[model samples]
Target: MAGESTGKKKKTGMKSFIGGTILTDERISRQFPFVVMLAMFGLALIMNRNWSEKTIRQIGDMQKELEALRSEHATISARLMDASRPSEVAKKVNEAGIGLKEPVKPPRKLVVEDN
Candidate 1:
């Protein structure tokens, strides 16, 4: 009789688990908080990984934009340097018919003697 009862208990244990009644068991109910905590930790890990990938993608895009901007800056700086040359300035002034002329004489400084 005792052996038959023990066998029946084991079968009921498996049946309870398969039928979802295991969640209502006293032992499992006691540890429900721990199970929930583990679930939260798993969710947090997934979220962290997703956020890290997003940040990395953004950084890559920013780096590409930075390189483009740097190239543009270099091109503009070269153009500015070319435009600021004395010959270029004189040519532009002549093209504009502004009638401004470069002085041929060297600049002279005047000195005043105070008594």
Candidate 2:
């Protein structure tokens, strides 16, 4: 009788263990979709933050490039203006080995009498 009672207790213990695990599994399965939705929402938030940061960084780089380009344009425009001056043009022409020289005498107007 004692041996039979021990066997019955062992079976009851195994049945309780299995029953507890099954209940736990059912609860977990019921909540699985909620967990997945929360995880996806968190991932979306992280991606949005990263995308905004990257876009802001790109905008900053473009602004810096624009300022640099503007500065270069101003410098080139000034140089061009200086080079277009009459004195500067004469100096450049002389450096090119041209034979042109400033005239010393005033120009005289020629009048043709119509016949």
Best by TM-score: 1
Expressed as tens digits, the lDDT of each residue in 31-115 for candidate 1 is: 9999999999999999999999999999999999999999999999999999999899999999999999878898999999999
Q: What's the true lDDT of residue 76 in model 1?
A: 100
* Global lDDT scores for all candidate models: 0.90, 0.83
Q: Give a tens-digit lDDT track for model 2, residues 10-66.
A: 333567566875435555669888999999999999999999999999999999999
Candidate 2 residue runs with Cα over 4 Å from true position:
1-23, 101-115
Colliding residue pairs in candidate 1 = none
Candidate 1: stretches off by over 4 Å: 1-15, 108-115
What are the TM-scores, per candidate, against the unseen true structure? 0.78, 0.63
Give me candidate 2's TM-score against the actual structure. 0.63
What lDDT would candidate 1 get against the real structure?
A: 0.90
